[model samples]
Target: MPQPATGPTEANTFPALCAHTHLFPGARCRLQGLSDPHAFTAAPWSIGVDLRFSDDAAAAAELRTGGPDGPVLAVPPYTTGAGTRIGERAWFVREFTWVDGEVELRIGGHA
Candidate 1:
C-alpha cells in the first residue's frame, strides 16, 4: 500500500531547506518516493539529488516584480544561484513556494 505524503510543517519548511542549497552549493536533494509506502519500515523512500537553483532571468524578474511587501530575491553570489526555471514539478517539485531571500537547504538526517 502507498503511504501518505509529507505535508509542509515547521520541521518540513521546504523554503529553508532550499535556502541551504542556495547558501551552500550542492546541498539540496529531490526525493521521488516509491508507490509502496507501507512496504517500508518507515515511510517509503527512494532516490534524491543534491540540487542548485539556475534561475537567472526569473530571479531578476522576481526582483523587478517584487511581491506584496518585500525587496525581492537577492542575486546569488555564484552562477548556480540564479536562473529562469529553478525546478519543475512537471518533472520535479513544480509546486513549491517562491523563495526570494537567501536560505540554506537543510536536508533531514544529515543536517
Candidate 2:
C-alpha cells in the first residue's frame, strides 16, 4: 500500500474504479511485504496477515500492534457462492471512512 503525499503529488483515488460495491466491515484482510513460513504456532494461522476486524475500539487497537507499521493492505471480504469473480491480482482501496485513513480494499476483478 502506497501512502499519499503530504505536499503536491499525484492523485491516487479509486472513485470510478470501485463505483458500485458494498464496503462491508468485519472482512478478512492480508497485509503485504511481510511473510514468515517458519513463524508457526500450535494451530494453523495466517502468516503475516490479519483476518478480522471489529467494532470494538480497544480490541482493534490491540491488534494493530501485532505487526510492523507498513502500508497495511487487505483483500475485501466475499460471501460464499456469491460469484464475485475476484481476479488473481487487484489494487487495494487507498481510502475509507473507517480505520483512520488506512488503505482498505475494494474489489476490482479483471474481466
After superposition, the stretches of candidate 1 with alpha carbons farther than 4 Å from their true spots are: 1-30, 38-79, 83-111
Give the per-residue lDDT digits (tens) of candidate 1, residues 1-111.
Answer: 343453211122122223342422233422223233233224222222233343322111111112233222233233333332333221111112212332222222211
Ten contiguous residues minimizing lDDT sum, candidate 1: 57-66
TM-score of 2: 0.20
Scored by lDDT, model 1 comes in at 0.26
For model 1, what is the error of residue 88's alpha carbon versus the real structure, in angstroms, after optimal superposition?
23
Tell me the alpha-carbon RMSD of every candidate: 14.8, 15.5
